[model samples]
Target chain A: MLENKDPNRTDLRELGEFGLIDHLTQGLTQSQPSTIKGVGDDAAVVDIGGKYLGITTDMLVEGVHFDLGYTPLKHLGYKAVVVNLSDVYAMNMQPTQVTVSLAVSNRFPLEALEELYSGIALASRIYGVDVVGGDTTSSNKGMILSITALGFGKPEKVAYRSGAKPNDLLVVSGDLGGAYLGLQVLKREHEVVKVNPAHQPDLGAYHYLVERQLKPEARKDVIALLEGLEVTPTSMIDISDGLSSEILHLCKSSGTGCRLYEDKIPLDPMVISTCEEFSLDATLVALSGGEDYELLFTIDQKDFPKVKGNPNLTVIGHMTDQGEGANLVSRSGSSIPLTAQGWNAFQGE
Target chain B: MLENKDPNRTDLRELGEFGLIDHLTQGLTQSQPSTIKGVGDDAAVVDIGGKYLGITTDMLVEGVHFDLGYTPLKHLGYKAVVVNLSDVYAMNMQPTQVTVSLAVSNRFPLEALEELYSGIALASRIYGVDVVGGDTTSSNKGMILSITALGFGKPEKVAYRSGAKPNDLLVVSGDLGGAYLGLQVLKREHEVVKVNPAHQPDLGAYHYLVERQLKPEARKDVIALLEGLEVTPTSMIDISDGLSSEILHLCKSSGTGCRLYEDKIPLDPMVISTCEEFSLDATLVALSGGEDYELLFTIDQKDFPKVKGNPNLTVIGHMTDQGEGANLVSRSGSSIPLTAQGWNAFQGE
Candidate 1:
């Protein structure tokens, strides 16, 4: 009954998450006058009289999004809220409230839940967002967390994914690759512990990377910094599914192309050292490693001086004409096509 | 470090969903000025310019909330959206936008997800709400659907569970017990089918009951009807956890007591007949068998004349002073205290 039906019954793995979402929501027509902008953005925008309210939702499944062996319940709870808040911040809005819904198995003790809630409370307090509402229910397997963040900003100040133009500078906040590398470290340690319970592998050297994986914070500070600098991004998004995937999203939504310089990609010293230890390319890790929770945006060239040499900001690339296609300028000065090989949840871990 | 922690870690089973949520959110403080109301209400209320926006979220897990063997993906999708919208309506607000997030197992085909989205599209069309944004991911087990609904209403017109006063007449829209009874029938049929592949139990006589279970509609019409009649509810809630549980919620939140007349409870002929067939007490089914999706609200005694003879509404009870606890006056003239032995997700199916 669907127009997009495949006679051979295509696997979700073939379409991937983004392609599946696009395929499913192909013809969705928004009818509400209050809906200023709908799908295909970091967050949906609603016209609420004096300002625009940005609404975003995210779902984190247990086995898919997390592994409880190393991930503390507290950090999991905090990270869940931060991820949703990142989407709101991507819209240049300060999250005012959030509703968290969970489907948890009975295997969790009340103490464990208290730990989770404590982390949630900490995130709410630290971010200045209220835990407004939530539903708690039972799950048959591992836990699932779904969070919805609501934020507001003046209509003129809010950024959208579809506002980029040619020559706009593409900038990113903080660094990348650390969270993904942290997950690798945790996984490696988990395997080691499974094989030899008495062996305690020192994780001190990878503390920064491990912490980024376990307790990454959203770049709410980036939003504030940009505002203080009087810089309005032409387009914006949060890098959750790797920098490459997010840049592709911005380029596709804005009908533009981009050229990202490999040397310009921000990577912490720890990230670089760890990449070498693992024999992985640092630039590739920075490009496709996900869960950075960093802000990626494009700014008009005229505002470049304001953000130039800013400690937290990195000028990584610039938007280009759609016909040029998105490419990464390697350190050796060769242009290579950028593909969105980000995390595909449908693909078994 | 939690004050409520037991020397022996308390199992989640001991507290159940509601008790656990209450226990976890004990000290959650709302510091955001935009957050006018938080936590306990059907929907969180946020002041947005001239109106109050109601935000609520619900999560439906496959084995916990539905059985794929009997439930059509389309109906499940529609029901998921409707249930969330019901919360917004319970706050006496008109839902204008919704964000649906799903985590489905790879077992589901593209067509299956299409069917689900089709149902969501249908719900949005029927309810006049916009499908704004969402996230889709993979789950390890069965499908999970989480929806967040956004709605708005004038500040003065918004109904809160805490607004009920003594002497206000408690009323309900449509009938109850049908949805719960429908579940009983579906569960019976599911068991029958499990035992014999060829067995197809006749369900023609229980059409309404089965439909109520599979595809219950939210009472957006009730809000419209009340508006048309110029009747504003002093307190309101949607019947999801049975009448007894809802009444207790209203009473506790409003700091009052309630008197529900067993004889005055509205039940369809189908509900009564099915209850008899199942040898279940019709009154108990109406009182504690939840998922009716009907609006239960209280109106001031002064405005009783407006809804007194309305065919769509039935005045089943009235508010009382807090000193007198909530009770149900039965046909035998016995006053039985109401208990909230409603669905407890953590208690297991």
Candidate 2:
């Protein structure tokens, strides 16, 4: 039991997600010379002579991150590793090893674990990262997965969130809003199935969106492409918490502002159709919808010629001075303030 | 929903803890040049030129690792960090940074998390390790804490479980069985409280044991002391799953045998008295009771004199030829085979 030392217990929601993290981590000191970067980054950078080692961790709780009714165990495991690797890639580093810790209840049998591990093995094989170590134990409820990914890159090559400069071109890899729309479809179908177990909903139309939600891949190819094109990003981050939130993080950390052009925002045709079907605004969905797992980065204006015609790359915005603030310039010529509607599992959403 | 592809499903308990890990990790290949060790060590070693970086992870699930009714959140936080650090210490390395991830239910408020972080911060300050990064999210059920500790040591200074040789002196740091006895005392008191809420249990008699269970510290001192004594253990492991289990692990990994003297096992007077009070065998309790968090190591016979007459170090046994097998020489002059009845959380015990 614990003694209530504080008479007024502050609710977690009152602090929100980022506020809570900042409050708890304030005044924390790094005591290691190897620790080049501690918190407030895509991954903590450890100086290891020839290159810096980027370390990052993420936890996925069942029911909060996924619904078992629709999520396959193999996909859950694969996505768990991939999401953490995305953070490493966000640092512009090559992931080398990972530690996967799992806590599961008795409901999962050995075969279920094998399927989960098979997915982890598949990810490791494809990502060229070694499964170095982990801890497996029993949980009181459902499954919880925590993955820590380690990566490395030269000091000059690795990107940080605070490196964006004024006038830097903002770029994003792939389309957005698909994962969120896919989740909405899955939830709707789940409700339908609950009402009638015999009902088999048609999902062929939303195949691409659903796949983006279930099996999102890290932009390892983008990193390699940048190297081949000799274009290094000034600032980079993985788009896990929606575009608005991630861009705000870059702007806040770099002491700059951004103006995203709504006309240039990339969206797959399927994403637009799904948004229309669901009666959701495509622009709003693209701005606030999370779990895209795409790479959002900023590059110098000099590198524009290298990435201008690349099909995988989209120039959506540019950095501005700190006084301008983060905004989205609409196609109608109206400026809208960007807000972070990032998904917070703590709010029980 | 998931379709059962396998008709026959095996329970996790059938495979036991180690068997399940072995089955899941079988045929896993390491392809990274930076990865020196994977899967089967106290910590995974990564090549970093001047020194090797050791990374290890451990997860603690509520209701499985600790009972919140008897465990304080602050102590739980401290113990969670310490247990993972013990793994890093087991490799004979100095821990530098740690990443902590917690999946907690909404039952806990911001103040509760602040208390938990306070304990974590205290441990980091005391151990001289930096809290580099962590993920804090919501869990569907109870709390789950996962910690990844990073450390570094010279290649020659790092000790692995497979490095012990025949005739090496088997040594253990501190006393065993106190933490297990401490848990027993707490559980007994909890039962009393459940029967009558007004009952004030007298815990003064089991103060040492209670403290051991509530706040077990890793052997950071032993690592420093060994260095001071100019002693490099041939093989080392932390006694997390009882003395017999750890001895067996060392023997199994090193491909050797061991002979432990029953009288040589260091035990506090309180452990002997408490074992008598509980009508339990003290020798058996010391042999099989887990969570001691002491260091179990092997050193060359030439280093015996250096460790001899040291109160903190106990020469419990010696490594023998592979064919000899692992045995415990009882005070009655009988040879008893050691078995690993170590705590398996997956068994729901």
Top-lDDT candidate index? 1
Q: Which number leads on DockQ?
A: 2
What digit string (tens of lDDT, one per residue) describes model 1 on residues B159-195? 9999999999999999999999999998899899999
Range of the 10 consecutive residues with the lowest summed lDDT in candidate 2 chain B: B1-10
lDDT value, candidate 2, whole model: 0.90
The residue-by-residue lDDT of candidate 2 on A1-349, one tens digit each, is 3434465777676777788788888857777888888888999998877889999999888888888988888888899999999999999999999998888777787888888998899899899999999988888788888999999899999999999999999999999998899889988998999999999989889999888888899999999999999999999999998999999999999999999999999999998888888999999888889999999999999999999989999999999998999999999989988988887666743
Score every model by TM-score: 0.97, 0.97
Q: Report the C-alpha displacement of residue A322, candidate 1, in angstroms.
A: 0.8
Write candidate 1's Cα lDDT for A1-349 as tens digits. 2223566776788889888999988857788988999888989999988899999999999879998888988999899999999999999998999988888876777888888888899999999999999999999888899999999999999999999999999999999999999999999999999899887879998999998998989999999999999999999999998999999999999999999999999999999999999999988888889999999999999999999999999999999999999999999999999999788888763
Model 2 regions more than 4 Å off? A1-7, B1-7
Docking class of 2: medium
Candidate 1: stretches off by over 4 Å: A1-7, B1-7
**Candidate 1 TM-score versus the reference:** 0.97
Q: Report lDDT (Cα) of residue A73, candidate 1.
A: 89
